[model samples]
Target: MTTAATSTTAAAAVPFRFFDVHVVRTRLLGRSMVRITFGGAGLTDFASGGRDQRFKLFLPHPGQDAPVVPTEAGEDWFPQWRALDPATRGIMRSYTVRAQRRTDGGAEVDVDFALHGADATGHTSSGPAARWAARAGAGDRAVLLGPVEPDNAGVDFRPPAGTDWVLLTGDETALPAVAGILEALPDGTDARVWIEVPHPEDIQQLDTGAQAEITWLVRDGADGPRTGLIPDAVRAARLPDGTGYAWIAGEAGTVRALRRHLVGDRGFDRKAITFTGYWRKGATEEQLVEEALSGTGPADD
Candidate 1:
């Protein structure tokens, strides 16, 4: 029962530790996303669980040199963080590991952030994380609560044995996870994927060995409206012939709707589908974290 799928579903805390990482470089991955490469001597021990690996990122306050995380508290860091002054405490957010590399210089991890700034209509909707990432530079410091083991609880994209094919759905928020999953898939595996982005330029070349049919849906397309683009696209398609496992993540509402469609209309086995609402519309990360800590909201959707 100690399979990769079971590892994430288990309630046991993941084997994670805190690391003081710094931005080594940044690259504009697309119009609405940026990839920040983090490196440090501490990263030598920072293991990435690969596909869809989730981790907590702590960014510094405006005037701080590095994020103020009580890493010395060890397993009790969360409670310590809660007790700190919110004004000076590090801003916390969750992100997926796009890739991990061990170059001659040192070990590095790439995290892709989705920029949600206002469109051409002159509005301000970007969150603290997005704003910070937009201006992040080389040598910027942050704290990371990342895995120390390769088979930790953070990696969630696990399809059971004998899975004939797989279905993946994600919006811009889940793009990093989806890309990681696609790259980790076994060669010749059948994968049906749908990705929604803010603009056509947001799409990128993804490397995968699986027989994946990836459809990119742009929200700003002049041809049509954007509501339910992924769901509608999947519904209209002819799925591969076999039992399927689905891993979905994106906007909360859309994720739920697509899950219902798959279970009710497509008749997929409920247990075979792993869904995560990476974020919700109009909800701040602080609010979600508060709810999660107080046990008042849904856990990992």
Candidate 2:
């Protein structure tokens, strides 16, 4: 029972590590998104295979050279950080590492930011990190922390040998993670993915090594409100028979709902599913972390 579709083993690969870096380049990738690339000496030690790893981005004050946060020089950085006034600590946003490359004497990481508009995290207004991403350019420097260590970073995603079925669900925030999963699946993996996005145009085309039956659920325009669409889609999905894992992520409510539906309503093994609430509807990045630490979020919606 170690097929590419049913295995529960953690990735045998070494876990990607954290590093500090500086912004080397930044630009607009879409009407409402920006792509920033970072590089520096510390990046040289950054571990590989960080495709879906989350990172903490630290931005310096508008014209400051170095950030005010304690460096690795401190033994209890996070505790010290927790004691600082939120407003004075600057802002930190959670983002996925879209891609990475190492060459010469440095490494580079690319991150995509959804520009603030009618819909966005909203903390982008005066937050140092947000403002930096909004207008960052070459020659700018900032601290890049993470490759957030997942509690189970090395988990191998292959299915058990006898299984032939699967279910996948997530939103734009989780797309990169889902995409990473999809890319790792073997050919002919019998899986169906339900993806939710703000607009039809937000749908990204991906290339996967596995055979996947994918469905896109658009939010807002013409597709009705996103609401409970992710779980609804999964509820109505016709997955192949046999054991499989259910992967879900995104906004807190949506992820909770899908997790409940899969394991609670459908009777799947709770341990067989991977669910993550990447962010919240109205919570800022700071609030999201506080909530996570407090272990408070709506019951798996």
Candidate 3:
């Protein structure tokens, strides 16, 4: 059931399309970030226009030959992944589609992974993602699942239909999604963005037609949850006088606080704010979602 403000969809029924692609290029953007570009025959079938969507990456098991991917459906890959025993199956993590390029003029998905530590597998401290990324070559095979398009199109939280301004807030974890949102905005749109990062170097410039005021909040010396900077930044922010929307993402507690400050304290229209807790500090994705939706709710910072 969908109200005027909210629409309920069968999340599980959403198609989980898979793609088998070959790594075409690799670039290290920073100490913790790596960009891998992939393309192949399977790439032709991938849908374009989903810059901000996310998908699951299935890494080949250690020392195993590249797995074959079925073009029609993804069920073939699941059994092989499950055969590794519950403990040995490679870790599957969610990553944003940074950019997409296609020869047919469709779209190719560009994914940037935070490779700060070990790969996904526990055999090494680093997870499998890092290990695979480190050794990835131009011809390596990768199977991608659920490049599900996000549902937030035309859903900006700005007050009044087609407002002139917006405020964006998030952490490093939300950078890819933030970039996509900014890219999708109309030219000459006016907006302000405040991003919290570990250091000043993490501030990457964005290309958006919107008149954007981006503030980078550094967390180098912060001891508590890295998201504490959002509250202070928002407090100091000077939003446009006209109707504006508020968007906040990243850590769970931080997002919750910003939500309250806007709708609860500042009295922004309830429909004028969108906040998503992408991930928690010390919890897995499943655990974070469970805690967030559970009646007990996630703990406060």
Report the number of the highest-TM-score candidate: 1
Model 3's alpha-carbon lDDT is 0.63
All candidates' lDDT scores? 0.82, 0.62, 0.63
Clashes of each: 0, 18, 11
Tell me the lDDT of model 1 at 103.
73
lDDT of 3 at 86: 36
Residue-by-residue lDDT tens digits, candidate 2, 107-208: 787776654332234344433444567766677766765533343343434344566676777776567667777776777777888887766667777778
Q: After superposition, how far is residue 178 of candidate 3 from its true place, in Å?
A: 1.1
Better of 1 and 2 by TM-score: 1
For model 1, the local distance difference test gives 0.82
Can you give the TM-score per candidate against the true fold? 0.91, 0.78, 0.75
lDDT of 3 at 2: 5
Task: Please tell me which predicted candidate would have the highest lDDT against the true structure.
Answer: 1
Candidates 1 and 2 compared by lDDT, better number: 1
User: On residues 165-226, what C-alpha lDDT tens digit does candidate 1 reach at each position?
Assistant: 99999988899999999999999999999999988889989999999999999898544223
